[model samples]
Target: MADDRKVALDAALKKIEKNFGKGSIMKLGEKADQKISTIPSGSLALDVA
Candidate 1:
């Protein structure tokens, strides 16, 4: 799965660099895990599909 996903991400990153500029791609990787884990219990919807 990781190998397949890396191929997909490589394609995506090239598109990002072409359309949005190289800086955007760098910024996205730099901030990928910078989100807050502040989900409120009971306020989130579960997806089964």
Candidate 2:
């Protein structure tokens, strides 16, 4: 069932990370949904314009 599939997928992901190192694979939805905070460029002209 879905639970079994999820278990298998988790095992595969762990194996991949163990061999390739962490953050070698990223889940798109998780990355895409993240909010990026913007900061000022610190230039007067750029900030005004």
Leading candidate by lDDT: 2
Off by over 4 Å in 1: 27-49
Residues 1-49, model 1: lDDT tens digits: 9999999988998999899866566634375535445645653464221
TM-score for all models, in order of appearance: 0.47, 0.58
**What TM-score, to 2 decimals, does candidate 1 have?**
0.47
Candidate 2's C-alpha runs over 4 A off are: 32-49
- Each candidate structure's count of clashing pairs: 0, 0
Best-performing candidate as measured by TM-score: 2
Please give the lDDT score at residue 30 for candidate 2.
55
**lDDT by residue (tens digit), candidate 2, 1-49:** 9999999999999999899987777666655445657678999888666
